[model samples]
Target: MGDSASRSRVSYPVFQDVNHMVIFGFGFFLTFLKRYGFSSTGFNLLIIVLGVQCSVLIEDLLIFLLQREDENSLKRITNAVVSMTAVVISTGALLGKTNPVQLILMTVVEIIVFHMSRWINETFLQVPDNLSMTHVHLFGAYFGLAVSSRFSEPLPRSEKNASTPKSDLLSMLGTLFLWVFWPSFNSVLAVDKSKAIYNTYFALAVSAVTAFLLSVLTTKDGKFRMTHIQSAVLAGGVTVGYAGHGIKYPWIAMILGLLASVISILGSYCLQRCLNPALKIHDSSGVHFTFGLPGVLGALAQVVLTVINNWTNSARQGHLVTVHIGAFCLTVSVALITGFITGLILNLKLFKTIPVSKYFEDQLYWEFPHLAVGF
Candidate 1:
């Protein structure tokens, strides 16, 4: 009963779109590493497979513990897919610096924490973020950064960390897939599904344009970086995540998208250089800019919209704003503490961590052809 029946009816097709984003979109998106293609795509597949199964089990266990009725099959699958997404985003930040065993272990720990945080946001705080503003994107990004910070050795500059022309092309393919499917992703649980879709589409289109323009302008040579194109172009979707379901105007989505693109592209151009040395965080795929900051922007946008909608009632406005901010703070705190602990566990000698010398090379895990011509 309730919203579950209706959610189930429309869930599958959108689920397929989101699943595509997880599989092909994310899989290839991380393939920008020239020598780490196999690890990038292969590790992503392994994590998603493990994450989905674990997430479903954890969600079901939690529901039973809470004495709540079970979600329908479709809804459960949808939630599992979404749960895996946070792990995938976190993986992006830790890519090339982690071994397969370490990644598998991290996936399990992160999924457990993610589901618990999600439950708290939904049950205790009644967070209204349909697109997982704080619970997924923000938490995933910061958690990965936190884990990366635990490494004693910084990610060294090496040829293997650089992308080849072919790898960049593959990464762009992933970006296009995400750009095309993101509207379906944002609208899956929206109250006004059509409006969510429309707003998300508008936001993405604008963000893409802004990313391209800035990439050229920001560089001394006035050339576009494949990194910016691959990552920054998608910030619009993250920025509009919480707002997509309720925003009443196309202009609002466009403005949010524009701001998100600027922040993401600028972070990559400026912040990425100093962030590692300054904070001891080595972000492999710039997740902090692409997901973290845009997520914060989206969360704030949602709070502003909540205020606007309840302007006539000061008491109601204050309560809703408090809930929104409280949820964000809780999600950040839980993710950082849990992620830091997980990092400490992974740092122990027993985990068989990746060596600094083998950071971004697929040869450590994958076999290659004698020539391996294009790769």
Candidate 2:
């Protein structure tokens, strides 16, 4: 028993140490890239890519935490909490200037836009049958970044599925490293470095706290389940895109955070039913697209609202409505065309090698032994 205990203790710290090393390496690489004359635009683009990747990684972490128990869950929880706490504490200590009001307002705007987009997608646009708001948001963020960076299509589903324990572990390391440098990414070109630093740190703190509390409260069977926290964090982050430029109200951010969380929960519940009449898919291994109609509509709704906002903002700034409309139309057209081309490209070659028959056979053999022969 003593030996076992010693081994257990050593294992966790070793895992943590490895995680730190990976993070350090990644940070050094990014720093080196910056020092080697990488453009400011390149740095911004890197942040956007890394941020979306981190978002996906965080989602995976939540799922892992939920699926694990005892020491595994505890270890995951400790890592998440400690990493976030370190970010918040260090930011507070290092950069103490921030606008609380602007922060709050930005948070609220983000939450509202996020939920509104989900609502719109659920109500209209038949894109797919099983897409969730979270998925849609992720797609939008990734899609947006891809457009901004002029990259090829996003990572394929097969590649994502092939992710293993080691890769996932590396992803967590990546997430923490991103968290540490988020302020720079968010505010790199800002005239007010002080405010940018403060806002970025504050948002990170809120996201971490919100994620932790939600994990604890919403988890079932020792697994970290999805909750309103996901939406809240995304909404808060997106809101920063706009609100960060305006007022920095913490209360507004908190209110937005709460609203986003509630709306995400309610919207997901309602849309899950509407879009998934057969309810064949489970959220256990990630949302399946076979039942993703409502999710498509949700995505459309978000697109519409964003269009309207852009139009209004541009008009207010005395730009031609045609320009705004043209821009929106161009963006949508490009996204659709690019997404299609990329999806096709990715589906070629080895992507087609994932034998569906084999997968189904394995599922029958292992997941439903009693029903494998149609008992």
In order, what is each prediction's RMSD in angstroms? 2.7, 20.3
TM-score (C-alpha) between model 1 and the true structure: 0.94
**Ten-residue segment with the worst summed lDDT in candidate 2?**
89-98
Model 1 pairs in collision: none
Top of the candidates by TM-score? 1
Give per-residue CA lDDT, model 2, range 105-191, as digits (tens): 222222233333333443443322122222332333222222222212222342222333443444344345555554543343344
Model 1, 1-375: lDDT tens digits are 867778666677899998999899999999998888998899999999999999889878887888978767986777788778889999998889888889999999999898778778887888753644335888998888888788765446676778889999998999899899999888776778899999999999999999999999988899988888887789999889877878888999999999999999887756666866788777888899989999989889989999999999999999999988988888888888998998999988998888887888888888887758885
Instruction: Show where candidate 2 strays beyond 4 Å.
Output: 1-169, 222-235, 256-333, 348-375
Model 1 worst lDDT window (10 residues): 127-136
- Each candidate structure's TM-score, on Cα atoms with residue i matched to residue i, is 0.94, 0.39
